[model samples]
Target: MLQIDRWKRILIIGLCVIGLAYAMPNLFYKRVEAHNDAVAAVEKAGGAATPEQEAAIALWPNWLPSSLVNLGLDLRGGAHLLAEVQVEQVYKARMDALWPELRRVLADQRSTIGAIRRVDAPDGQLRIEIENADQMSVAVQAARGLAVPVATLTGAGQDDLDVSAQGNTLTVQLSEAEKALTDDRTILQSLEIVRRRVDEVGTREPTIMRQGADRILIQVPGIGSAAELKALIGTTAQLTFNPVISTGSSADATPGIGEIILPSQEQPGLYYTLEATPVVTGEELTNAVPSTDQNGAPSVDFRFNPTGARKFGEYTSANVGQPFAIVLDNEVISAPVIRQAITTGSGQISGSMDYESANQLAVLLRAGALPAELTFLEERTIGPELGQDSIDAGRIAAAVGFVAVIFLMVASYGLFGVFASIALAVNMGLIFGILSAIGATLTLPGIAGIVLTIGMAVDANVLVFERIREELRTAKGPARAIDKGYQNAMSAIVDANITTLIIAAILFVLGSGPVKGFAVTLSIGIVTSVFTALWVTRLMTVTWFERRRPRTIEV
Candidate 1:
């Protein structure tokens, strides 16, 4: 009567084999990691590997599962950075773009509004004074016409700009709702750009997320230091091509309103005045790669999207023989004269850069520019030695807990406890196997979760063993007692584990960072523990009883 079906026994054995197989790589972490890295390098190098790389690859078989549970920042040591994004910079850029449209709308009534002049205002505000005082209403109305509905959920039906007029001066600024939306968008974009930049460098399991209103938290494991991480992402790399107005050696030379002065990269102290509006910006770039120019000099070759190509073609065709400045982060890299129209949509950027610089520039361009500047507020570098110590501590704690649980289970339940202990081991293997398959990161808190699971894993076995003892006291044979014991304990086991699993899910949904890691491990442990207790231990017990055909059993 107490027996596992042929298919069910096969399924249980199959799962145990698969789980242990997947978990095998963690036993040889360094060798497996090196093999993985070498494989990646070989693929990156187009299936060509050096002698050392080939040796590393040969260390592990390609047919076996090589996935390992990624180590979290706390367990691997790395760079941590807290940066505040300068979101207001985007507001100034928005206002600058709005100026031309607002000016044109007001100019339609130039006869009434008279002379219009832009006045200096705060960074995020646009203020203009008109000569005709009585016609201020017309200017205000025209400026308000440029206001559009905010596109965010909370700011629905709200206008993006708040326009007000005092005397002959009309002032315009972003609405409060729009500002909030913009801040959210700015942080999201900044997060994405930072992720792309970090991913380009091939770091493992970097934690890049929004911290607050305008802050980002970045934790990259295996990086050298915080300064090195900062260096990789700090550059704004804002590239724009603007029509050059004039060239001058004086830094203080004023270039009228709507034009900017930037120093040349090659010629020290030499500056070029360029139009404020660019013909094409880096945002329109579709692709960029390092290449050699006509003179065999290092350069970055770039291709533009259709819209950018059209704008570039028209600008070059109309301004033939005119110089256009290639500006990067407000500094002019070069001001080359356009000898002919460039309708091909591709161009090269050449300056005082070598191949390394060109390659770095190409990477940055391909990743796109940061939406705004970032000011680092806090930075810390964690050493790998500390991470290794934490890892060792976790391992010891888990092993101690595991051994203590095994000892108690065996002493209390006798032979039944041995079955439970074996199931517990299988439960751990399943936990790690699932983690490796899903590529979850293991943190210190995750280790804590696993240790806690080791203690909890025996609960079902205890219940089943106690029930078997009760059945044996009622004079039931070993087979009936075993079957009834498992059946009677099923409800309690499911009830307890289900409630804990719900809590784990809630923790995962509401928490972040280490809390999330703990929740993930705990959740996986619960599922695997339940399976091993209900199916694995029961199968082993049934097989033993069937083979022995014992008339009575000691608990």
Candidate 2:
């Protein structure tokens, strides 16, 4: 028993020492670069740099660790937004895909389904009007298998011969299977696109996650306002080359007019014609950077591929002094009059763009564009003020708690309490070391988890002492009682700690951000505390007894 106790103490202390060494980086210098940057930015802003600013500036070392794994939005001052993806758009895409098939089906079985007419509704809604009541019923029945779980059949009015409505207003409802297919594809595509775009923007610790049904949650730390986020995700980013149509007032308005028509890829009924030929297409874009023109006005300078350059030169050379429209996603962004041919592969986009707008456009162009529009559904940001307060409060609370726990243990158990306190200190060190090693963010809730572990850390000691007391009452020798105490209490200790660990695991899986942090610390604490209390303290006690060979074991 004495030997076991001695070994346990040695292991616990050694591990704690190793942990402290590993985590020493965190204790001394955590956010050197960020602090220095903050100070520099403040100085640049013409604000008076105070002593605290100077101290922060002095504290930051270039070689030190960065400000990663810091507190979250609740601790920091930031904006939170909830944006939802437009699911109806996914449905529309599916319908557009089925357009050719539907047309084919209708032509084959003309008697089965009635004449089909496409109708455009408000807010991008499309409807397929089914003509003739009896024929419509036949068509609806025929389309049942295509779009499963069709809604209740709507009857045509007595006077009205046209089929008023069916499920989805297309004489067929989209099946659960169809919706699932469309939803999955849309979400998967949107997520990937959003991630790529955000990553390009270079926001620190950006979080773009999918939510319920058709929603995406985006969280960008240190980016307080989401005006930038909105600009990035809200755009469908559909880039196309379109010719400018002449207003017929002047020859310059012709913009190298052309008459080529391109059919819409997504929609059969939709077709676009270029009144003037595009000098260059977005596909040729290589890079775009925000820069100031000769007049010091903000603009986006873009470079194109060799093919685009050749085409641009040809188009401009043929039609000098004509206005060429720079179209983006079907909207004319700029209509610059061509003074000369741009033979080089580079072009400048000058519009009514302010400095910020120009910079944002440059960022977007650089990041590439999303294939589809993504609506944000949920967001949460940690505020810097809240984070600082949490850190201060957590530090104080932990300090006071540790001191109280130490006093209580020593006061209650005398010599045994001293042993427990040593083990407790080691437990704290191990937890911190592990957290630092894993680069775990210490949240406010996580601090609470650590405090909770403090109380529970003494549990094993309580059990051992009680068992020793019982053994003493039974007239067992000092060494014999100590051995029996550990032997008897081992089963109870394992069962109780294991149950707590299980609960912690469940909490981690089910809970959200902060909750998960709390669960993590709590779970880790339970394991470390058990190890320290059961082994470290026991070993120390055994070593002391074996060395001193005291005849009397003080209760």
Candidate 3:
């Protein structure tokens, strides 16, 4: 180990330089973070960077990597929320939607099932009573014909809807297979929408994940409280194009068989009777972005997929001069008469929107509608002062641990102990460098892992140095003793590190939140300590031996 090759020397020095380069950003943490945030903001707006932000970014060179360590919620003081998606709401919605389709289909064959009437039913069931008793079989067969295959791995080959008939009354509900598919969609869509809404605020390292069948876990670092998060994701933005049947202020205005009355969201006491079946929904949108309308007012520009575009174009051409209500979450956003057909797939939404509200609406539309409303099951707030207290405590613990380890190592083996202490310091720098590079979140538990690492980092050096002393007692020369010490201790060092690595991997896979964070720092520290001990310290000693050629060494 004392005999170092020229290639190994270059490699070791190069790694040290690279590690320091990455670690340098954390020293100027606030400045680098502001620069990154400004860059992200400018890119999001599709605008040029301001002079101030550009100057801040220029403080750090462009050639060097810019990633910094991401602080966890406990460190940064942010919002935490556990929201449960009301999947049952989607079931009722599905049934309500089925009423119109069932009415239309059974109406086409009016002679068979005469005077079909929707009666009272349970939450997720559609109950239709036919005037003709013997036509129950005919109604069941028609409803069953509307069934489609479930589109999930577990639900494939099963019908999406179940239809049953008894004593002239027909009942329809989602099959078990359809409920499974709907639950999956609800949770996944909720997760994505929550993530998009948080990201639009330009916050960093927000954790949004699915917890169970209908629950989502959201932890956003740097936001003030759970109420702010709720406000961000509260809007549904479920836009639709429904043909207008009538306009009135009467909230109780009963409608025709194919019509429903809904009040406008912005306008109080204004009701609109619109066709139950929509021309298209927000789901068909391919893109939506904040923009300026022709009148220079803030608006949202949207583009539809090919299918939606085709349907919209045909509908507009067939029903020229007719009014269509632009509904959002069962409320009318606008109802304008169609003067001419819009052949293009793209259009803009203008409703006296200010810049901020327009941008928020655009983000919600881009994220797509959540499958169902979410109930806030849990909420929390972490103050920055509390985070600072924890940080200060952690720093004190680390400093005391470092000093104790350094003093003990120096007292034990003099020059060799000093060498080990130097390697240990470099080992820590490497750990920070790796964590920054991987964008790992640093929590309080993570700090404890690093302190633990400081205590354990010198084990390899200790084993090697003790073996060197044993060799010296056997009458071997200093150079030969050092070489023998490193070679003989290699097996124990490798075995110990490998075993620890296996445990860290298990913790990372099985544990949650802070536990995973601890595993990350511990794993990174182990790899770095092994490199510093086996290569870095050995290189230092070999260079010293080559230059001084000492006849007798204290180590």
All models: lDDT?
0.92, 0.67, 0.87
In model 3, the Cα lDDT at residue 419 comes to: 86
RMSD of 2: 9.7
Per residue, candidate 3 scores C-alpha lDDT tens digits across 138-205 of 88889988999988888878999999988978899999999988888888878888888888777888
What is candidate 1's lDDT per residue for 267-368, written digit by digit as tens? 998999888878899999999999999999999999999999999999999999999888998889988999999999999999999999899898889888
Residue 138 error, candidate 3, Å: 3.7
Question: Best candidate, TM-score-wise?
Answer: 1
Candidate 2 residues 1-555, lDDT tens each?
446644555666678777766555555544544474566667665987777677777665545433334444554444455666666665554455455556666666676565676655442233566666456655655444243332233321211111235643553334454455556667777777677767665454454666677777666655656675676666765444445444332222322212333333333443444542344556577788899887898988998778877887788888788776666665556666789877887888766679987887776666555545565555555567776787788889988999999998899889988999999888887887787667676667889999999989999988988888888777557888887888899999999999999999999998876788899899989998888877878878887888988776866
Where's the lowest-lDDT run of ten residues in candidate 1? 471-480
Better of 1 and 2 by TM-score: 1
Q: Give the TM-score of candidate 3.
A: 0.93
